[model samples]
Target: MTQQVPDKLVIAISSRALFDLDESHHIYETDGLAAYCAHQRAHESVPLAPGVAFPLVQKLLALNTPDPQRPRVEVILVSRNSADTGLRIFNSIRHSGLDIVRAAFTGGASSQRYLAAFGAHLFLSADAGDVRAAIDAGYAAATILPSSGQGEGAGGQLRIAFDGDAVLFSDVSERIYKQRGLAAFAANELAEAGTPLPGGPFKEFLAALHRIQADFPQDAAPLRTALITARSAPSHERAIRTLRAWNINIDEALFLGGMPKGPFLKAFGADIFFDDQQGHCDSARVHVATGHVPYGVANEAPASLPFSVVSQ
Candidate 1:
């Protein structure tokens, strides 16, 4: 008799994201999605980039033992294709015996657009904004890296860094910092020092991670997280107090005020860094993995850098 688990895990995936193989591996004569699905059904393992979807999924499933009380792991597949395609993929999911709860066809122009709105406990896709939205919505998300099909860099832990203002903490402080500049932002944070700042996009995921850590206290995996922001000294003080108040454990935090983050991120070995400023992402990407977050005060928007902001 399997021990029943009371709660269920909801994972929202794109029909294509679940495919077994890297569709772009061989020359494709058919449409990308169709060829991709065909390859998966043929048992051709797709080459997922390091620190990407398949690795994360594999890790999660490994954690899922038979919990008689907990509902079976459920995967919700979303796609922008016709119902026929969705059904075909759904059938494939069923045949594979993967824990699939449902399938939805969003029929949007881009699959990324649809996946962002398909809320689940986790979202896997390459869209930066969609990934940001999913994180904002309290879902764990990972982007499919284009290169290095498998395995993380040797010895180094997979490092993920988040910007404080909009990506990790509420944009309220960020907007103040942007509109009236740093001095005003510091004053406001000092005022709200005792009060908890509203959680930002990554709050839910951070909480989930804490829960996971609590469950598996002995096994501290190589996953590390950090907060890199441009708020130094007095300003950084309140943010620190806020996180402490929330009981979120961030492995590393840098209070860089008006300093380029690329070098610091390089030092931290950040696999990926998320920030609302295009310039920050631009500079950071040269030395480390970087993503541009598109939210918060419109005026504080960092100028577009030479790097690609959107994930392919």
Candidate 2:
């Protein structure tokens, strides 16, 4: 008998992560599964389209090593489909020239239940429930950004750039800025530079990525992180000192004085750029992958508000 091999990484990706769907169609638009089935029946020649995270998973598959001695990353797809559909999709991917380490389908209505029970190093989904469940399970789960769907390789070190004020730090300072204006917030930052603020929700995710990167020595890590913020001159100093005190080493930092960030992030060849403001993230998408952080503020009426910077 051949020896069994253990996986190096366990990645659970949702169906939406693997297929593409029409953006105009709402989940309810298709009478749920029955409608989807009918549509599939009509388009007999075409399989359900690939999803947003398809490209990212494809890139990940390229990173796998064939050597049995080396750690191997395993990707298991969990979806709300029949086992047969799952296997068929897996086979389709295999035939499409993707060297999959492994694949599976959960065949459950809720992707979260399957993810929690199966457990993986990471879980990816466009569905918030799956994302949240993976995060709750202490996994680095994230929603697939549209740009990440189209992204090719690291393009070099998989540059991940973040804004400082509302992306990495708490939104308290941002609230102060919005309520009292820029000067007041600047003064507070100057004063509180020595004091650590509450960490942002993405803080844990960043730290986890950092730890994974730590597997490589300081001299050679495949991932690089940067901080690009609107904070200017003297104010920028406070952020530097604060991050240093907090022991987070940002690979590159820019203090643009209320200038557009697209140029700089693009110049850096970032794989993903995240900001709380949709405007900034929108602009960053022109050059790289970008994402929006939903605000945790209570009682706030949600709207199609253009992105205003927030404290992450």
Residue 161 CA error for candidate 1 (Å)? Answer: 2.5
Instruction: Report the C-alpha lDDT of model 1 over 1-312, residue by residue, as the tens digit.
Output: 333243445566664456632344342435666674455445423233322343444444544553434543455666654564455556655555555556677654444444444445556555455555655555555443342223332254446678887767778877665556666777887777777778766666566555544444434544567888888877777788878988877877898877998788777766566676677766776766454555556323346322322211
Best by TM-score: 2
**Which lDDT tens digits does candidate 2 get at residues 1-312?**
222245345567766656665531353264676565555444434455566555555554543433435534456777665564455455556655655544455554666566545546566666766665554554555565565323332453556677765557666766776556677878987887777666655565556456546666776666677888878866776778767766777788998877888878878766666676666666676666665554433113445322553332
Write down the TM-score of every candidate: 0.63, 0.70
Candidate 1's TM-score reads 0.63
Error of 2 at 151 (Å): 5.3
lDDT of 1: 0.58
Candidate topping lDDT: 2
